[model samples]
Target: MTLHQRPSLQSVPAYKQGKPAAAGASKLSSNESPHSPLPSVLDAISEGLGTIHRYPSIAAPQLTAELAALHQVDPQHITLGAGSVEVAAQLIHAVAAEGDEVMYAWRSFEAYPSLVRIAGATPVEVPLDADSKHDLPAMLAAVTEKTRLIFICNPNNPTGTVVEAKALEDFIAAVPRDVLIVIDEAYVHFDRSAVRADGVELFKNNPNVAVLHTFSKAYGLAGLRIGYAISPLEVAENLRKVAIPFGVSDLAQRAAVASLHAADELSVRINEVVAQRERMYEALEVAGYPVVKSQANFVWINAGDDTLDIEAKLADGGVVVRAFPGDGLRISSGSELDVDRVIAALASVREGAQA
Candidate 1:
């Protein structure tokens, strides 16, 4: 007899990781920090190797306290997960179940649909606006009695478009108090916009709001897989309940703590990344592509049907970028050489298109 599996799982799509580049090509497929880990972070990780035989602290008390102090929130409101994505999954399970609905912007995060379906909730997707930002008005209109949770990816993945502060605050005020609003601020550090929504501040006044952050992005800790949520005390408690035992490793916890201490160094690195992102956005626009105004560490080119063709050309030019097939392309801001190669590749592709 064939082994039994959950029927819902058969239709669930596996998460697709960014493709790796060949030798000599710059891999900007993943929106990761181009800079190396701070020396202090490296030292912390090396020191943690001494405890290889022991299990990591289940509570991760020290790291939790540091984060609490940093955000000026009660430690009770903080919850750690393997990554923010894992925390998102936990939150979906905590609030929604069979027959319930989880809502988010379509093309916001590729993982949203899979996460909702895994929790046995129906995924309700609202399409993005013409500019590629979340259509919050439409998203709020889609909210039905069955809607339990909504995810708003600020500086949304793949597009790097943000819903400005005033607009976002208004949307929060209008949303039903019972429905949880998850502000996925994964790219907040790179956002230089004057009107960017402060997710942490928003979470404090609104008990129904939860802010998901990841060490994987700004802190250069993708391999370590450490992330956390600033949520209401009850939600935080439930997140802990669903968390995998010994999920945050000793190295990850210590490294994150050290990284938090080196804020000045991180700020300098972040500024450089932001500068590069702006340069890349402008360069793409001048090169004749319809590039979105990005506030994150990546630029989005609305290539539509030409995505694959441009992606192949970029790959041939020793540069790699993430392409969303028929949607567009997402290219991470990297070193100067990487940016130069991207410009050249884009110019070459546009010329070929015209011919």
Candidate 2:
């Protein structure tokens, strides 16, 4: 007899990571920081090496306290997870059930649908607007009685588009009090827009709102896998209930704390990434690609029918980018050299098409 599996998983596909670069190619496929860990962060990780045999502090009190102080929230409001994605899963399981619905923008985070499906909840995906930003009005319209959760991915992944502050405020006010709204700010540090929505600020007066943050992106702690959520006291408790025991390793916790304390050093790296992102956006536009103005550490090229062809051309030119088949391509901002390679590759594509 065949071993039993959940019927819901039958249609769900496994998550696909961005492709690794071939020899001599610049890997821009993954939205990862190109910088190495700071000396302070490395020292902290080294100090924790002796504690490997023991399980990490389940509550991660030190890191939790640091995060609370950083966000100006009480420690009770914080919950730690292996990563923000895991925190997202905990949030889904905390409030959603078999028939409950979880809503988000389509082509936002690729993991949303699978996470909801794994929780046995129905996924509600609204399409992005023409500018590739979240269609908040349409998302509000799609909410129903069964809607238990809504995720707004600010500076949305792959597209690098963000919802403005005022519009997001209105959307939050209009959402039902009982429906949990999670503002996933995985790329929050890279967003420098004047009107960018602050998730922590939004969560202050709104008990139904939660803010998710990760050390993976700006802090360059992706390999360590540490992230947290600031939410209502009750929501935090439930999130803790659903989280895996000792999911966050001791080294990750130490690295996150060290990274936070070394904020000045971290800021320099972030500024470098932002600079590169701007350079890339400008170059892509000059090459005749209708690139979106990204506030995150990447730019979106809406390649449409030419996506695959462009992907192949980029490969030939020793550069790699994340392609969304018929939709577009998302190129992570790497070093100055990487941006040069990407510009050269796309220039070749444009020249070939014109020829």
Candidate 3:
């Protein structure tokens, strides 16, 4: 909000993040896991405490190596990020020139257009399909010579439907090689579907693509804010060119490294959430509200009703959910206690529907 801020910065809307509820209010607004950290991750963080006085490795080499190994890619193919959001923003800054256009599906991340405008670029948003799915065909047509960047939010935000893998591959084939395509797979961990786009694999031989992932979702480490990108060596080079050094702190780097090692345990926890998501989806669908097949941990409330009424009723009953101006309501997967509260709130809505 500085007077000297660039005009482009003026119209960029603030990102809306979910906050924890008051002292005792249970929070299910943010799409966060209701689980405790792994003991291994805690030990790593505690060990890192001894090195706080020293500056963190600017490159986050140890963590990068681990990530590369896990992804079966060379270390040069990796670039660490504070979070996948940072990696997404870096794509915009690194590729799009002022006045160039950055395109994405509307109601995607909510951050896409803002970050685009911040880069002194124009945002071309293609509205989602009537069912709230990304209109991939429309997005493909939105690109013009001015388009330098495009973000595909798989299992897209607010609406959890993932673009079919074949459609994604065909879309990539249609896009011009000069433009950088970012596959934001923040929720990949919870995806049990075999048909989802594998961005890392998609970018294997392609330099025009970048795959972003984060520990925030399935890793249950949102508080730590660890994420990374896998891309061609040249793409990684360009990302680092615009990336600020030491972007990730010592503690976060240590925690992420520990997390990669605790993979089996993390998978078990994610599967539990996936199971819960299925049960929630079936319950919602059975109750007569339309529910999309969610590939992520959270489910999208069909937005089929007046979201305001649904939101107000839920809040009054002591459950917190995120309702957009559209009919969409994002209900985070929660602990049994939190989930029960959400179910009770919905039960009232269900009755009102039948009334």
Candidate 4:
């Protein structure tokens, strides 16, 4: 039987977070680091847990202050959320009314389109270029009077492509004043290349632009689900209003604050991931797979792309990666062991092609 559906209740495509692999399998699917929370961060969370019987400081004052100081912005300029993804959704919900349109690049964050839909808004998806980077000009052209929000995911998820600062600056200039622009930089710290947008700097100037950042990536705090948005106070207040109360847990708030001080240590570890990403890219390219220049922790495999089929084969080889149907697989990546595992799995596929 066909199910009756309201426009808001229609089947909005869901974000496909990958399944966890078997205990011994190297899981590289969810873009989660193979690593765990830092020892100090773990200690911080443990300390916070002792106070769990009490409701966390809903304001997250200490955490927010640390974030404000780090970003060189006022605490009032920030709104903490469960993760940067949640912050992104809040930004859309803040500026858009039901049926108003939100625009973003396709295959960017699998979540963006669905999140907009769930907010009772229309999602406009502009396709990425052949190179897999966002076609910003085309996206700008698609913006309409109903376009209340635009999402720009730098070093975009799944595709791992980035918009350089110059291009980003140009794109921002063309955006209408009435529209809210969200720059999702969930994996920014993992990026070492110079060709990337500094959303923080952009937010410091443009009241219309809101930037979402998270400690999940380089800080090894994904489990804490701690992230925040930098926006004008007007926008920040709106986001805070729409947010579910106390979404940022006490432990998460505390751990994220501690993690912020470990940047020097995290940078060294992140550089290692960057090097491994380059190696993974080289290996895939050498084996004749189409790869985008990755500026994120993972590399995208555009395997022409039997994404699901390829994923199954990698699974047999004990490596779990993310598959996006026609877009191929996104290998969340790891150190030498994790990288080598995926390379071997893809290599086996390449060798079989010739057979």
Candidate 5:
């Protein structure tokens, strides 16, 4: 006899990661830092090797304290997870239930719908506006009485588009107090926009608001899988309840703390990534591709029907980018050499069309 699975899972699809690049190809499909780990971070990880047989501190007190000091919040407000994605899942499970609704922007984070569905909650997707930014007004209108949670992916994934600070503030104010709003700022470090919304600042004054951050992106800790959420005390307590025991590894916790201490060194690498992103954006625009000015560590090309073709061309030039079938392509910034390969590939595509 077949094992019975939850009926709600029938509609859920497994999460798809960015496609791995072929040999000799620059892998820009995943938004990851191209830099190697700092010496300090590496040393911290090495130091933790002896403790592998033992369980890590369940509460992750050290990491929690570090993050609290960094964000200038109470340690009680912080909750640790394997990654921000897990923290997000914990948040869903904490607030949402069967027949409850969780809302977020469409084409934002690929994991949002699945996370909501896995919690047996209904998913409500509000379409992004023409500029690919979150349509705060539209999202506000979509909330119903059953809406238990809302996710605002600032500097939204895939598109790398961000909502303005004032607009986000107005939207947060408009959202009903009963509905919890999660400001997922996984890419916040890469954001250099003048009008960026600060999730931590918002969280400080709003009881219903929570901010999600990950060491996976800018910290260059993707492989280590450590992230946290700063939420209200009640929500944080519930997140701890839903979190897998010792999910955050000892090495990950150590690396995260070291990474934080090595921020000055990390900033140099982050600045380089930002430079490459700007260069890629300018080159794509010059090649006649309709690209968005991204504040994150990637550029979004509105390739429309040509999405797949462009993706193939990029691969042909020894570069791989994330493509959303008929929609567009999201190219993560790599080294300067990688940017050269991408521009060269897309330039050839433009020339071929002309021919």
Candidate 6:
């Protein structure tokens, strides 16, 4: 006999991960930090390894304290999880239930819908405007009585477009005070724009808002899966309730603490990545591709109908990039060598199209 499962789950799609590169290919699929962990972070992780036999502290006290101090918030206002993604899932579970609605911009983070579905909450996706930026006006209009939560992926993944500080603040003013708003800032380190929303500062002012951060993207700790959410005490308490026990490993916690202390070093690395991102953006623009201006470490190419074909061409040229079929291509600013490969691949595609 077949085992019973939620019928709605049948429609849920598994998260699509970046494709692996072939031998000698540059992997620009995942928006991972091209650099290795800082030396201090490595040393910290090494020091923590001897205690792996023991269970990791469920509270992750040291890391939590470091983050709290960094954000100038109480420890009670912060909740740690395996990653910001997990923290996001926890947020959904804490406040949402069957029939509740979670709203976010469409063509945003690919994981938003999946997380909403997993929570048994309805996903209300408001489409992005022509510039591939969040249409805050439309999003505000879409908010309904059933809406329990909303996600604003600042420096939104894939597209890498950002909602400016003023626009974001105005949108917050319009949102219902009771509806939970999550600012996913996984790529915040890469964003240097003066007009960018300071999510942490925003959270301090807005009781219903939370800011999500991760070590995965800019911190180069993706493998360790450490992230945290800064929210109001009540919401943070609920988030911690749903978090998996010992979710933030001892090694990850220690490394994250060390990472905080190594801010100068991290700043240098981030500047390098930002520089590379700009270089790639210029290259794409010069190559006549419709690329979105990105504040994240990755750039997006609106390849339109040529997306899949260009992706295949790039793959064959030993440059692997994340392709959304007909939508566009998302290419991470990886190593300098990888950026060269990407530009070369784009040139190849352009030549072939002309032929």
Q: What is candidate 5's local distance difference test score?
A: 0.92
**CA lDDT, every prediction?**
0.91, 0.93, 0.83, 0.86, 0.92, 0.91
Instruction: Give the lDDT of residue 129 in candidate 3.
Output: 95
Best by lDDT: 2
Q: Give the TM-score of candidate 1.
A: 0.98
Per-residue lDDT of 2-100 in model 5, one digit per residue for the tens? 998788788999988899988778999889999988999999999999989999998888888988898899999999998899999999999999999
For model 4, how many clashes?
A: 0
lDDT of 4 at 355: 95
Model 3 agreement with the true structure over 199-264: per-residue lDDT tens digits: 888888566888889988888788887788887676788889887777878999988888889889
Candidate 2 stretches greater than 4 Å from native: none
RMSD of 2: 0.8
Model 1 Cα RMSD, Å?
Answer: 0.9
State candidate 5's TM-score: 0.98
Name the candidate, 1 or 3, with the larger TM-score value.
Answer: 1
Candidate 2 backbone clash number: 0
lDDT of 4 by residue, 131-162 (tens): 99989999999999899989999889988898
- Could you tell which candidate, 3 or 5, scores higher by TM-score? 5
Can you list the residue pairs that collide in candidate 3?
303-327
List ranges where model 4 is wrong by over 4 Å.
1-7
Q: Give the runs in model 6 whose Cα sits over 4 Å from its true position.
A: none
Per-residue lDDT for 1-355 in model 6, tens only? Answer: 9999989999799998899988888889989899988889999999988989999988888888888888899998988899899999999999899999999998888988999999999999998899999999999999999999999999998888888999999999899999999999999999977678999999989989999999998889999998989998889889878888888889988988999899999999999999899999999899889999999999999888989998998887798889987799999998888888888888888888779
Residue 168 displacement (Å), model 2? 0.7
Tens-place lDDT digits, model 1, residues 1-355: 9999899998799998888988888989999888888999999999988888999997899999999999999999998888899989989988897989999998888999999998899999999999898998999899999999999999899899998889999999998899999999999999888788899999988869999999988888988999999998888888888888888899999999999999899998889888888888998888789999998889998889989999999998999889999999999999888898999988898888789
TM-score of each: 0.98, 0.99, 0.95, 0.96, 0.98, 0.98
CA lDDT for candidate 2: 0.93
lDDT of 1 at 196: 84
